[model samples]
Target: MSIDWDRRHCSRKGHITYAPDEAGLRNRLHASTAVGTVWRCLRCGDFVLGEPHGSGPAELAPLVPRGRALRDLFILRFLAVERVLRGVLVVLAAWAVWKFSNSQDAVHQLFESDLTAFRPVADHFHYDLDHSPVIDSIQKVFDYKKSTLHAAAGLLLLYGLIEFVEGVGLWFAKRWAEYLAVVATAAFLPVEVYELTEKLSWFKIGTLALNILAVLYILIGKRLFGLRGGHAAFEAQCRGASLLEVEVAAGEAGGTQKEPLPVRQRSSTADPA
Candidate 1:
């Protein structure tokens, strides 16, 4: 009989009151099963004595081992967190641009009005107004056209949206998200490398390394761009040591059982007097 492996809970049997916890069930089954045998249901937590026929016992057919999936999920979550932080930064940048645009007139007025008074304080601090690149840049920003500020804010918002989308998609383990992340991250590598060439810093190096690692992990581990036999090979690997496959192999090696099979019981501890 064909089984819908996607549905984890046993609806007809009503084994569990709530929805079946696949992770919990997997741990229980892994601990219960013998070294060479596969006998527990990852879905419904039922013991499999023989091939499940007419709902006798739900077969164990995990798409991937829980341990490996957990690790992959953890990596995805880390990437998601990074993307989310980037999104927030870009959003804050957009807000900063908006605020600056609104307050530039006041700032310019204040700078012009206080130039005489500020120069004494600047002199006291040994600051050179003629050679301060930071002050020059601030003055240039304050003089920038309104259209340019709007365009900058728009671009920042767009980039923030993209980062937010990538974070949410990766969090859900979507294949499209993996592709988007890899492409977007790789696209920034050239710019990052150029920045590194301009100025060397540990922060820049670390950021570059992280992006490279993320790209590599998505391409190799997720089997993107037909690497390592692509998705088909990945799927096969996931199903290789599955419970259903093992049971089928065992049945093919031998004949069908006529009587009920013996259930392996764990040794119990004795109560002390």
Candidate 2:
């Protein structure tokens, strides 16, 4: 089923109605009813009750997003949310790594004591602590040098910061943020693939897929890197969604738009009875 992105956004954010200085366009966008005046919402092109949100020249009208533009914004915000989550999670992981590095000795001692305590019980159940995969994983971490652990933590923190920047930029729909996200995501694809090669997991696969999709969607849909006529074309697509821009473009192209018919009046008496 098709989604009405325009109406969906308007429902959440409320209608954005404008009164243009140009009489022709203004009349087309507003109307008088028995109750009061209503203005046409730029976002949904629907007449709404009450005064307009803004009054200005046609050129000064707000570029309220609709249709595919709204959909694109929706997708970008979704990616932004994902980026924010990644930023938070990685930052926490980095902190955990740093803390673990600082208290390695204490942690190692505690693990040994606990393992010793569990040894008799494990032996009774025919479970060998020495060969346990989970225990081996922890022991291997203890094998890392303090400096190595600190370095790993630093890298994670830096990556988290980058993700945070991407998230904020994308949430605001900034062009530079789109470029940054594309580059960062593309650069990580190889690492993600390599990880999958080492150990196959659903979480890893899903993250990789989302990153890949984000990169492609931004690059192609946004016309980045001269693809699909680049930045100019992208801006043009955005402007096309604006009614004022459409009227201006039509004027420049020598095309005339037909104004809407006037509202009908109900006759008090029967017609020519």
Candidate 3:
């Protein structure tokens, strides 16, 4: 019995394959195609080799081949390193929280000192100093001057929490994590730029540059041509089992020398099973 090469199946890892019986011809696939296979399927009438994986919209370029997928995966894994970096940031944030929590007197002092500096800007921005319940409560906590310091510290704590979440997601190669990190990095760019404008320093410049690079890498480098999806598919394609394999094995048991049919080129995209 001939296995219909028309049907598709998950080969080994996750690659979609056609004509699984002709395992010997697997390496004969063209190297330049998407997943590095040349076999075609009569069922789909689409080229199965080199098709992009996943259901997302088609990107600008074709699916990256298996070899290129390996390289891209390596580069992207570096972004996961941010987890270690966030560990250090988390420590700093905890310290800040502790210091602010204990030093109510210092908060009061700083608020008092910065009173005049903050008032003009606060007023110009139409932030009600009197009727605003939030600011009113802060004044009670740490006088007018230290109120802003308390608020700043609170903001930093929130940022720290967000960073922690982002770090965890990225480390696990979650898609949402990549999207969140890109957004957070972009949101920080304006603030970093504003800081540099106030007083251009080497440290500030370097910090801003790093943030920009991080955003770029996440949005463009990681998503547009990232390998996590494609690499997983290519590995699947390299697997040697399929319905065709079963038929070929049975034929051999019967001492039949039936020649495996030529692998057909599938016209439709290969679903990375």
Which candidate tops lDDT? Answer: 2
Per-model TM-score on C-alpha atoms: 0.69, 0.87, 0.44
Superior candidate under lDDT, 2 versus 3: 2
> Who is ahead in TM-score, 1 or 3?
1
In Å, residue 68's CA in model 1 sits off its true spot by: 2.5
Backbone clash tally (model 3) = 20
How many angstroms is residue 186 displaced in model 3 relative to the true structure, after the best TM-score fit? Answer: 0.3
Candidates by TM-score, descending order: 2, 1, 3
Q: How close is candidate 3 to the true structure, as a TM-score?
A: 0.44
Estimate every model's Cα lDDT from 0 to 1.
0.64, 0.81, 0.51
lDDT of 3 by residue, 155-211 (tens): 766777777777766655555776887888788788888887878999889767876
Q: Model 2: per-residue lDDT, tens digit, 123-192? A: 9999988899988998999999999999999999999999999999888787889999999999989999
Given candidate 2, what's the lDDT at residue 177? 91
